[model samples]
Target: MDMQTINTFLSTTAIELLIKVGAAIIFWIVGRWLIGKVVTLMQAAMNRNQVDPTLTKYLGSIVAIALNITLVLGILGYFGIQTTSFAAMLAGAGVAIGAAWSGMLGNFAAGAFMLVLRPFKVGDFVSVGGITGTVTELGLFATTLLTPDNVYTLVGNGKVFGDTIQNYSHMPVRRVERTAQLAGSVDPLDAIVRLKAAIAQIPNVATSPAPEVNLLDFKLEGPVISVRPYTHTDHYWQVYFDTNEAIARVGKEAGWPAPASTQIHRVTQA
Candidate 1:
């Protein structure tokens, strides 16, 4: 071809490429804005219906991801790229990734199941997968917990769902199990009465079941007094510590000697 004709051809090709690139940019921006709007609307609707915030956020994330993927595919199609082949490639990659990240996929599946089962919600105090803490977030692949010691922990949802889950906040009240040792000379009946009165006076103790102060067992040093107080999960630690102090206070006021084991040695001449 002559140089003039070659130059014209090159100019047209470059212009077309530029226009397509510009259009793709605009499409991406618009697509992203629309996805955000859709997610916001869906979340608002869920909130209006009083859906759980954890579920609302989770669903929103899923929907946003799906829409973003669709948008990317659409953009690829606009550039005259065969989306069918691209989708096939994506499917193959997904399979490979799924195989390699089986545990992550399991966690994702468990998270979905947990959302349906509603075992525990965010902010619930629970012991799951051998970790005890308050749930901070129920995520796509993991559950975030804020422990009693102020540590944030992430536990795989698969592990959490597979193991025993104890929801301390499920019931209205939880029982704090504590035992006190009394001097062998101390009266068991008197101790029980004293403990019951002290535990009842502790703040946040439940009134319905009342505090249970009873003879648990006999130790070598003293009689064991079971001092169990029922309280809301929120106030559990407070009530627990207070109950211990109350036990000590009662012992001090009663002037009961600290329990000590006495062993006798028999000396024999053979």
Candidate 2:
């Protein structure tokens, strides 16, 4: 090739390279700033709606990433790169990744739904899918809890929403049930009447509902007395402890022994 032609070609290549480099850097900086703004907006929106902090942070990150990707593609196209093929490749790769992590995605979707619906919130005691604990944190894929014994547990959001949730803290009032065994000879009618009176006197117990005392069954030891009473949820523990003590004291004062099974046998020798 002639020297003149070589020089012209080199000049064009250098200019093109500089333009591409400048475009990429500008796109990166502007895109990052814009995504940051979007994330801030998302956080503001979440805060306005009282969304959980964990979920708000996760959603903001996702929005930032999506914005960054879009800006990157636009910048690439400005440098004369064909984005159709690139977009297709991205879509294909995304599909593969999505298929591979389908379970995780389901958890993410479920977590989003949980965030919106708010079936339970942090600090609430709930039982779901056989796991009982107080909610500590909620995330896109999992929810963390602290058990009564203070053990940390992480349950997937998908499983949590998919299964039934027993929210013990949802209501202002809760019922406490206790089954006390007595001698079989104890009169069920008298025992129930005394239990009702005893439980009634306990502080925080709801008088409107009236405590229920039922003879559940007669066992080898005694009759099983199912004593249930309604109390304010906040005073659940207090009522539970008081009611238990009251039932025992009342039964003793009423002259009724918890029932017990009786057996008799005879032996004859020839």
**Runs of candidate 2 exceeding 4 Å displacement:** 1-10, 182-187, 214-224, 233-238, 262-270
Can you write out model 1's per-residue Cα lDDT over 1-270, one digit (the tens) per residue?
A: 999988997799878888999999999999999999999999999999887777788899989999999999999899999899988998999999999999998998998889878899989999999999999999868999999999999999999999999999999999999999998999999989888888888999999898888899998898999999999999999998999899999999999999999778999999
Per-residue error (Å), model 1, residue 83: 5.1
The RMSD (Cα, Å) of candidate 2 is 3.2
Q: Lowest summed lDDT over 10 consecutive residues: which window, candidate 1?
A: 49-58
Error of 2 at 244 (Å): 3.0
TM-score for each candidate, following the candidate numbering: 0.76, 0.83
lDDT on C-alpha atoms for all candidate structures = 0.93, 0.86
lDDT of 2 at 129: 64
* TM-score attained by model 2: 0.83
